[model samples]
Target: MNDMLRQIEPLIPALRRYARTLLRDRAGADDLVQDCLERAVNHWSQRRDDNPRAWIFTILHNLAITRLRSSASRPRHIAIDDAQEETFARAPSQEDGLRYRELLEAVARLPEDQKSVLLLATVEGLSYAETAGVLGVPIGTVMSRLSRARERLLKERDGDRGAQPVAQLRRVK
Candidate 1:
């Protein structure tokens, strides 16, 4: 329907962004978004009208979880082309770029639950209630997971800073 298109069209970018953060791979994220769109279209009649954003997100999140779980059970195999592509990947050269990469690595190190909560809340700009609805968890659980995620990231940042050598002053008098 035209009404459905009008509503869903505006949400594609957000869905793609959320999918990218969830999967950590651009191609996989795009595929997941496509699958989610397909599923959403097929189930449009069943979805509650009160919150289509949350509903769509819920569908994507569930599909992502299923994909992640299934993938975890299988051994990972990188194709020769993919491995060769990694050799050509650019490394961070500037201090800001390095810091940004480190931040991303730190986020990647977070437990899946905490990472999901953090991404949905901060990266996707979802409120606690909306995040909880998408994740199918209590709002309090979302709050706690987000709190723990922030604490862990802070600790990781502090640890990285502490790992660097500090310059000591020499007595030159």
Candidate 2:
């Protein structure tokens, strides 16, 4: 038990980071992490030791899905304070800030599965296999999702598709 805590302690920050990315709400993310720890501690002794990191992540992932589903059935609300707290950028100019915000919105708009894979692999620095185990998906699926996620993010960051320039006509003589 003591050995387990030592190993698990290091992963908490990473877990919180991943949760924050997923939830986009600091309080919600903290709640998810708290729920994850509570569940892990409750089932600590019975859990398999082969991959404790994956197991704990799996718990966090499952709890996030449940919350997302429940929230979907109801109207979503974002407190102004939480939204302000979520931004990490200190913009040099308003244009840069706008671009940064757009990029973040693109990420938040990502499909949940792809978002999870991208955050787990890139943000959390998990190996492909570790991500697969955490999400219970195949390695190929993780690769595929990650690839698609990057492509979509790039596309959104590049342009506003279907946007057209407006034309003005001078007054006729």
Candidate 3:
């Protein structure tokens, strides 16, 4: 319906921006938005009268959350597309590239819930409240998980298996 289109039309860019922040890839984010739009069109009859924007956003947010969770569970592998630009930029040797790949793999090994919360909060720049709304959790839970995720990422980045204090390294290895 024209009414539905008009309401959702303005929200597309916002949806895409949020999705891009969540997925960290423009194409993946756009695809997620398209899927959300398709679902909205298909289920238009079921939508309630109030706050169509929130409803549509909830759908998109859920889809992105689900996707991030699933991606976290898969076998940890560095994304080729993600690495290509960095590879070209650095002109690193094969050995250095392998080290970078290992770092990515370690990040992938983190708990899915932590990864999702961190990405939603830090990468997407969502408010704690917004992340909680998107993730169906309390704001406190989001904050705690974000803290844990940062800690875990720091440990992995340092290759420190113990709870030792991490020293800041100015140079990239």
Candidate 4:
């Protein structure tokens, strides 16, 4: 329906971003989004109206998990072109760009559960309740995972900053 299209159209970019973060491959992410959209359209009648965004995200999250599990044993390959394009899309400043890439690498190193919670809550700006609904986890669980994710990232950033003990100075000279 036109109404459904209008509502779903606006969410495509966010869905794609989440998918790319989860899968770490643009083509796979795009395919996942397409599959999610198809599934959403097919199940629109059954979806509750109270929280369509959560519902849609739930669908995409579930699909992404499934895809990840299925592909866990396979080796991943990235096209050089895609890699170059992504590299060119970052911030112009070398320092900012390096920091951004490091942050993304830190995120990628996170456990799946924590990564999902972090992305849903922070990157997508979903509330705890909404993130909980999308991930089908308790709010407390979401909070715990998010806390761990944040702490881990902070530690990583600190480590990258070369945190070290300062030499003690003599009391008098």
User: Please, what is the whole-model Cα lDDT of each candidate in the order they appear?
Assistant: 0.89, 0.86, 0.76, 0.92
Instruction: Specify the poorest-scoring 10-residue window by lDDT in model 2.
Output: 84-93
Tens digits of per-residue lDDT for model 4, 1-173: 98899889989999999999998888899999999999999999999764589999999999999999989989876667667564557465788888887899999999999999999999999999999999888999999999999999999999846567768888895
Candidate 2: misplaced stretches above 4 Å?
A: 77-96, 160-173
Residue clash pairs of candidate 4? none
lDDT of 4 at 47: 93
Off by over 4 Å in 4: 77-93, 160-163, 166-173
- Candidate 2 residue pairs in backbone clash: none
RMSD in angstroms, all models? 4.9, 8.0, 8.7, 3.8
Model 3 lDDT tens row, 75-173: 656677666565457545798787876655665666767766776677556678767776788999989998998897777777654677768879778
Q: How far is candidate 4 from the true structure (C-alpha RMSD, Å)?
A: 3.8
lDDT of 2 by residue, 1-173 (tens): 78778878898998899888888878899999999998998888877765688889989999999998889889877666657733655655688778877877888999989999988899888899989988999999999999999999987765665376758788998
Name the TM-score of candidate 2.
0.79
Task: Give residue 21's error in model 2 in angstroms.
Answer: 1.2
TM-score of each: 0.85, 0.79, 0.53, 0.85
lDDT, residue 151, candidate 3: 90
